[model samples]
Target: MTDLLIRPAHHHDHDAIWSILEPILRAGEAYALPRDWDRERALAYWFAPAHHVFVAEDAGAVRGSYTIRANQLGPGDHVANGAYATHSEARGRGIARAMGLHSFETARSLGFAAMQFNLVVATNSHAVALWTSLGLREIGRLPGVFRHPRYGPVDALVMHRSL
Candidate 1:
Protein backbone atom coordinates (compact mmCIF):
# COMPACT_ATOMS: atom_id res chain seq x y z
CA MET A 1 0.00 0.00 0.00
CA THR A 2 1.80 3.10 -1.19
CA ASP A 3 0.84 6.45 0.31
CA LEU A 4 -2.13 5.00 2.18
CA LEU A 5 -4.28 7.85 3.49
CA ILE A 6 -7.51 8.06 5.44
CA ARG A 7 -9.86 10.77 4.29
CA PRO A 8 -13.48 11.72 3.78
CA ALA A 9 -15.08 9.58 1.08
CA HIS A 10 -16.15 11.20 -2.16
CA HIS A 11 -19.06 10.29 -4.43
CA HIS A 12 -16.74 8.65 -6.91
CA ASP A 13 -15.53 6.23 -4.25
CA HIS A 14 -18.90 4.49 -4.02
CA ASP A 15 -17.90 1.63 -6.31
CA ALA A 16 -14.76 0.85 -4.41
CA ILE A 17 -16.59 1.29 -1.13
CA TRP A 18 -19.35 -1.03 -2.27
CA SER A 19 -16.84 -3.58 -3.41
CA ILE A 20 -15.55 -3.74 0.14
CA LEU A 21 -18.99 -3.61 1.72
CA GLU A 22 -20.71 -6.30 -0.35
CA PRO A 23 -18.75 -9.29 0.90
CA ILE A 24 -19.19 -8.20 4.49
CA LEU A 25 -22.88 -7.67 4.01
CA ARG A 26 -23.26 -10.95 2.17
CA ALA A 27 -21.36 -12.89 4.75
CA GLY A 28 -23.55 -11.56 7.58
CA GLU A 29 -20.90 -12.84 9.92
CA ALA A 30 -19.85 -9.83 12.00
CA TYR A 31 -22.47 -7.20 11.31
CA ALA A 32 -26.22 -7.21 12.05
CA LEU A 33 -27.11 -6.24 8.53
CA PRO A 34 -29.23 -8.49 6.29
CA ARG A 35 -27.36 -10.74 3.95
CA ASP A 36 -30.00 -10.23 1.30
CA TRP A 37 -29.50 -6.47 1.17
CA ASP A 38 -28.98 -5.18 -2.34
CA ARG A 39 -26.24 -2.90 -3.53
CA GLU A 40 -28.52 0.13 -4.00
CA ARG A 41 -29.92 -0.07 -0.49
CA ALA A 42 -26.54 -0.71 1.06
CA LEU A 43 -25.12 2.27 -0.75
CA ALA A 44 -27.85 4.58 0.51
CA TYR A 45 -27.58 3.22 4.03
CA TRP A 46 -23.82 3.73 4.18
CA PHE A 47 -23.66 7.13 2.48
CA ALA A 48 -26.58 8.67 4.29
CA PRO A 49 -26.09 12.28 5.36
CA ALA A 50 -26.38 11.55 9.07
CA HIS A 51 -23.11 9.63 9.09
CA HIS A 52 -19.51 10.51 8.29
CA VAL A 53 -17.97 8.05 5.81
CA PHE A 54 -14.25 7.64 5.18
CA VAL A 55 -12.03 5.61 2.92
CA ALA A 56 -8.44 4.47 3.26
CA GLU A 57 -6.65 4.86 -0.04
CA ASP A 58 -3.33 3.41 -1.10
CA ALA A 59 -1.71 4.15 -4.39
CA GLY A 60 -4.92 5.85 -5.49
CA ALA A 61 -7.05 2.77 -4.74
CA VAL A 62 -9.54 2.21 -1.97
CA ARG A 63 -8.36 -0.37 0.53
CA GLY A 64 -10.81 0.07 3.37
CA SER A 65 -13.75 2.19 4.53
CA TYR A 66 -15.57 3.16 7.72
CA THR A 67 -18.65 5.13 8.77
CA ILE A 68 -18.90 7.15 11.97
CA ARG A 69 -21.80 8.95 13.59
CA ALA A 70 -23.73 9.49 16.81
CA ASN A 71 -25.17 6.28 18.20
CA GLN A 72 -28.40 7.95 19.08
CA LEU A 73 -30.18 11.29 19.19
CA GLY A 74 -30.10 14.04 21.85
CA PRO A 75 -28.61 12.83 25.14
CA GLY A 76 -27.43 9.51 23.78
CA ASP A 77 -25.71 11.37 20.97
CA HIS A 78 -22.67 11.86 23.17
CA VAL A 79 -21.70 8.30 22.30
CA ALA A 80 -20.44 7.65 18.81
CA ASN A 81 -21.04 4.66 16.56
CA GLY A 82 -18.89 3.32 13.76
CA ALA A 83 -18.82 0.52 11.16
CA TYR A 84 -15.75 -0.59 9.19
CA ALA A 85 -15.17 -2.71 6.09
CA THR A 86 -11.88 -3.71 4.50
CA HIS A 87 -11.23 -5.12 1.10
CA SER A 88 -10.76 -8.87 1.39
CA GLU A 89 -7.37 -8.49 -0.25
CA ALA A 90 -6.38 -5.95 2.40
CA ARG A 91 -7.05 -8.03 5.49
CA GLY A 92 -4.33 -8.72 8.11
CA ARG A 93 -2.45 -5.59 7.08
CA GLY A 94 -3.47 -3.33 10.02
CA ILE A 95 -6.13 -1.55 7.99
CA ALA A 96 -8.90 -2.27 10.48
CA ARG A 97 -6.85 -1.30 13.53
CA ALA A 98 -5.66 1.92 11.99
CA MET A 99 -9.20 2.81 10.96
CA GLY A 100 -10.51 1.99 14.42
CA LEU A 101 -7.95 4.19 16.12
CA HIS A 102 -8.54 6.96 13.62
CA SER A 103 -12.28 6.80 14.21
CA PHE A 104 -11.73 7.11 17.97
CA GLU A 105 -9.72 10.28 17.52
CA THR A 106 -12.19 11.65 15.01
CA ALA A 107 -15.10 10.92 17.34
CA ARG A 108 -13.45 12.60 20.30
CA SER A 109 -12.66 15.66 18.21
CA LEU A 110 -16.36 15.82 17.38
CA GLY A 111 -17.13 16.00 21.14
CA PHE A 112 -18.26 12.44 21.70
CA ALA A 113 -17.63 11.16 25.21
CA ALA A 114 -17.53 7.52 24.24
CA MET A 115 -17.95 4.99 21.45
CA GLN A 116 -20.28 2.01 21.33
CA PHE A 117 -20.65 -0.91 19.00
CA ASN A 118 -24.32 -1.79 19.41
CA LEU A 119 -24.27 -5.24 17.91
CA VAL A 120 -21.05 -7.18 17.48
CA VAL A 121 -21.91 -10.77 16.65
CA ALA A 122 -20.51 -13.05 19.30
CA THR A 123 -19.60 -15.69 16.76
CA ASN A 124 -17.10 -13.33 15.20
CA SER A 125 -14.33 -13.92 17.69
CA HIS A 126 -11.72 -12.07 15.71
CA ALA A 127 -13.74 -8.83 15.84
CA VAL A 128 -14.60 -9.36 19.49
CA ALA A 129 -10.93 -9.79 20.26
CA LEU A 130 -9.99 -6.80 18.19
CA TRP A 131 -12.51 -4.57 19.90
CA THR A 132 -11.34 -5.81 23.25
CA SER A 133 -7.74 -5.07 22.28
CA LEU A 134 -8.88 -1.59 21.31
CA GLY A 135 -10.08 -1.15 24.92
CA LEU A 136 -13.79 -1.66 24.30
CA ARG A 137 -15.42 -3.85 26.94
CA GLU A 138 -18.29 -6.19 26.43
CA ILE A 139 -20.92 -4.44 28.46
CA GLY A 140 -23.88 -6.59 27.45
CA ARG A 141 -25.09 -9.34 25.19
CA LEU A 142 -28.32 -9.84 23.28
CA PRO A 143 -29.19 -13.48 22.75
CA GLY A 144 -30.18 -14.61 19.30
CA VAL A 145 -30.00 -11.10 18.01
CA PHE A 146 -28.15 -11.67 14.79
CA ARG A 147 -29.00 -14.07 11.96
CA HIS A 148 -25.84 -15.52 10.55
CA PRO A 149 -26.15 -16.94 7.06
CA ARG A 150 -24.53 -20.18 8.11
CA TYR A 151 -24.65 -20.18 11.91
CA GLY A 152 -28.33 -19.33 12.14
CA PRO A 153 -29.27 -17.00 15.02
CA VAL A 154 -26.36 -15.83 17.12
CA ASP A 155 -25.80 -13.58 20.09
CA ALA A 156 -24.64 -10.01 19.65
CA LEU A 157 -22.29 -8.36 22.10
CA VAL A 158 -22.41 -4.72 23.00
CA MET A 159 -18.93 -3.27 23.31
CA HIS A 160 -18.33 0.16 24.75
CA ARG A 161 -15.42 2.38 25.74
CA SER A 162 -14.90 5.92 26.96
CA LEU A 163 -13.03 8.04 24.49
Candidate 2:
Protein backbone atom coordinates (compact mmCIF):
# COMPACT_ATOMS: atom_id res chain seq x y z
CA MET A 1 0.00 0.00 0.00
CA THR A 2 2.99 2.28 0.30
CA ASP A 3 2.84 2.90 -3.42
CA LEU A 4 -0.92 3.20 -3.59
CA LEU A 5 -2.04 6.57 -4.89
CA ILE A 6 -5.68 7.75 -4.74
CA ARG A 7 -6.31 10.42 -7.31
CA PRO A 8 -9.03 11.88 -9.49
CA ALA A 9 -9.65 9.84 -12.62
CA HIS A 10 -8.77 11.18 -16.05
CA HIS A 11 -10.10 10.31 -19.49
CA HIS A 12 -7.08 8.10 -20.15
CA ASP A 13 -7.96 5.99 -17.12
CA HIS A 14 -11.12 4.55 -18.76
CA ASP A 15 -9.67 1.21 -19.82
CA ALA A 16 -8.00 0.64 -16.48
CA ILE A 17 -11.20 1.56 -14.73
CA TRP A 18 -13.30 -0.78 -16.87
CA SER A 19 -10.83 -3.63 -16.40
CA ILE A 20 -11.62 -3.56 -12.68
CA LEU A 21 -15.33 -3.04 -13.12
CA GLU A 22 -16.34 -5.51 -15.84
CA PRO A 23 -15.77 -8.75 -14.02
CA ILE A 24 -17.37 -7.68 -10.78
CA LEU A 25 -20.40 -6.30 -12.59
CA ARG A 26 -20.69 -9.34 -14.80
CA ALA A 27 -20.50 -11.62 -11.79
CA GLY A 28 -23.77 -10.00 -10.62
CA GLU A 29 -23.13 -10.55 -6.95
CA ALA A 30 -22.51 -6.96 -5.87
CA TYR A 31 -23.55 -4.08 -8.11
CA ALA A 32 -26.88 -4.10 -9.95
CA LEU A 33 -25.55 -3.34 -13.42
CA PRO A 34 -26.52 -5.53 -16.32
CA ARG A 35 -24.25 -8.49 -17.06
CA ASP A 36 -24.37 -8.04 -20.82
CA TRP A 37 -23.51 -4.34 -20.84
CA ASP A 38 -20.83 -3.38 -23.34
CA ARG A 39 -17.74 -1.39 -22.46
CA GLU A 40 -19.23 1.82 -23.82
CA ARG A 41 -22.41 1.56 -21.74
CA ALA A 42 -20.45 0.66 -18.64
CA LEU A 43 -18.01 3.51 -19.10
CA ALA A 44 -20.80 5.96 -19.74
CA TYR A 45 -22.47 5.13 -16.45
CA TRP A 46 -19.17 5.36 -14.56
CA PHE A 47 -18.33 8.68 -16.14
CA ALA A 48 -21.75 10.22 -15.70
CA PRO A 49 -21.53 13.96 -15.16
CA ALA A 50 -22.68 13.83 -11.57
CA HIS A 51 -20.16 11.21 -10.55
CA HIS A 52 -16.82 12.29 -9.14
CA VAL A 53 -14.62 9.36 -10.09
CA PHE A 54 -11.22 8.47 -8.69
CA VAL A 55 -8.74 5.64 -9.18
CA ALA A 56 -6.30 3.88 -6.92
CA GLU A 57 -2.94 3.60 -8.62
CA ASP A 58 -0.17 1.32 -7.39
CA ALA A 59 3.17 0.77 -9.12
CA GLY A 60 1.80 2.75 -12.06
CA ALA A 61 -1.23 0.52 -12.55
CA VAL A 62 -4.80 1.25 -11.63
CA ARG A 63 -5.75 -1.30 -8.97
CA GLY A 64 -9.20 0.02 -8.12
CA SER A 65 -11.66 2.84 -8.60
CA TYR A 66 -14.44 4.65 -6.68
CA THR A 67 -17.06 7.32 -7.18
CA ILE A 68 -18.58 9.98 -4.92
CA ARG A 69 -21.72 11.95 -5.62
CA ALA A 70 -24.78 13.38 -3.98
CA ASN A 71 -27.05 10.63 -2.70
CA GLN A 72 -29.95 12.70 -3.95
CA LEU A 73 -30.94 16.19 -4.96
CA GLY A 74 -32.16 19.30 -3.10
CA PRO A 75 -32.55 18.47 0.61
CA GLY A 76 -30.67 15.22 0.31
CA ASP A 77 -27.55 16.47 -1.44
CA HIS A 78 -25.59 16.75 1.76
CA VAL A 79 -25.23 13.01 2.06
CA ALA A 80 -22.72 11.30 -0.22
CA ASN A 81 -23.43 8.22 -2.31
CA GLY A 82 -20.36 6.28 -3.36
CA ALA A 83 -19.24 3.02 -4.96
CA TYR A 84 -15.95 1.14 -5.18
CA ALA A 85 -14.51 -1.70 -7.27
CA THR A 86 -11.20 -3.53 -7.21
CA HIS A 87 -9.62 -5.25 -10.17
CA SER A 88 -10.48 -8.98 -10.31
CA GLU A 89 -6.86 -10.02 -9.83
CA ALA A 90 -6.30 -7.41 -7.12
CA ARG A 91 -8.72 -8.80 -4.55
CA GLY A 92 -7.63 -9.19 -0.86
CA ARG A 93 -4.84 -6.65 -1.28
CA GLY A 94 -6.74 -3.95 0.72
CA ILE A 95 -7.49 -1.90 -2.36
CA ALA A 96 -11.19 -1.48 -1.47
CA ARG A 97 -10.45 -0.42 2.07
CA ALA A 98 -7.85 2.06 0.94
CA MET A 99 -10.26 3.57 -1.55
CA GLY A 100 -13.00 3.64 1.10
CA LEU A 101 -10.94 5.51 3.67
CA HIS A 102 -9.81 7.89 0.99
CA SER A 103 -13.47 8.43 0.09
CA PHE A 104 -14.23 9.64 3.62
CA GLU A 105 -11.71 12.41 3.37
CA THR A 106 -12.71 13.21 -0.17
CA ALA A 107 -16.41 13.29 0.68
CA ARG A 108 -15.97 15.45 3.73
CA SER A 109 -13.78 17.84 1.79
CA LEU A 110 -16.54 18.10 -0.79
CA GLY A 111 -18.97 19.29 1.95
CA PHE A 112 -20.87 16.05 2.39
CA ALA A 113 -22.05 15.51 5.94
CA ALA A 114 -22.64 11.77 5.63
CA MET A 115 -22.57 8.80 3.27
CA GLN A 116 -25.23 6.25 2.52
CA PHE A 117 -25.29 3.11 0.40
CA ASN A 118 -28.90 2.46 -0.59
CA LEU A 119 -28.33 -1.12 -1.61
CA VAL A 120 -25.38 -3.11 -0.34
CA VAL A 121 -26.13 -6.62 -1.55
CA ALA A 122 -25.90 -8.73 1.58
CA THR A 123 -24.27 -11.63 -0.24
CA ASN A 124 -21.20 -9.60 -0.98
CA SER A 125 -19.66 -10.37 2.38
CA HIS A 126 -16.36 -8.64 1.73
CA ALA A 127 -18.13 -5.37 0.96
CA VAL A 128 -20.50 -5.75 3.89
CA ALA A 129 -17.64 -6.38 6.30
CA LEU A 130 -15.45 -3.66 4.85
CA TRP A 131 -18.20 -1.08 4.97
CA THR A 132 -19.13 -2.05 8.50
CA SER A 133 -15.55 -1.84 9.69
CA LEU A 134 -15.21 1.51 8.00
CA GLY A 135 -17.98 2.89 10.31
CA LEU A 136 -21.05 2.38 8.15
CA ARG A 137 -23.94 0.81 10.00
CA GLU A 138 -26.74 -1.13 8.44
CA ILE A 139 -29.65 1.20 9.06
CA GLY A 140 -32.16 -0.86 7.15
CA ARG A 141 -32.49 -4.11 5.30
CA LEU A 142 -34.69 -4.90 2.30
CA PRO A 143 -35.39 -8.59 2.39
CA GLY A 144 -35.09 -10.50 -0.87
CA VAL A 145 -34.59 -7.36 -2.88
CA PHE A 146 -31.49 -8.25 -4.78
CA ARG A 147 -31.79 -11.19 -7.15
CA HIS A 148 -28.25 -12.47 -6.84
CA PRO A 149 -27.23 -14.49 -9.85
CA ARG A 150 -26.24 -17.55 -7.91
CA TYR A 151 -28.08 -17.03 -4.65
CA GLY A 152 -31.48 -16.24 -6.10
CA PRO A 153 -33.33 -13.46 -4.26
CA VAL A 154 -31.33 -12.05 -1.34
CA ASP A 155 -31.43 -9.19 1.14
CA ALA A 156 -29.82 -5.82 0.70
CA LEU A 157 -28.63 -3.41 3.36
CA VAL A 158 -29.02 0.29 3.57
CA MET A 159 -25.80 1.36 5.23
CA HIS A 160 -24.98 4.81 6.52
CA ARG A 161 -22.20 6.69 8.30
CA SER A 162 -21.43 10.30 9.10
CA LEU A 163 -18.53 11.66 7.13
Model 2 off-target regions past 4 Å? none
Q: lDDT at 35 for candidate 2?
A: 89
lDDT tens per residue, model 2, 15-98: 999888889888989987898898999999998999999999989999999999999999999999998999987889999999
Task: Return the lDDT, model 1, position 62.
Answer: 94
TM-score of each: 0.95, 0.98
Instruction: Estimate candidate 2's alpha-carbon lDDT, on a 0 to 1 scale.
Output: 0.94
lDDT of 1 at 87: 96
Candidate 1 residue-wise lDDT, 1-163, digit = tens: 5577999999999999989999988877877777878889998999989899999987788999999999999989999999999899998888888899999999999999999999998998878888999999999999998878888899999999999
Give the clashing residue pairs of candidate 1, or none.
none
Error of 1 at 131 (Å): 0.8
- Each model's lDDT comes to 0.91, 0.94
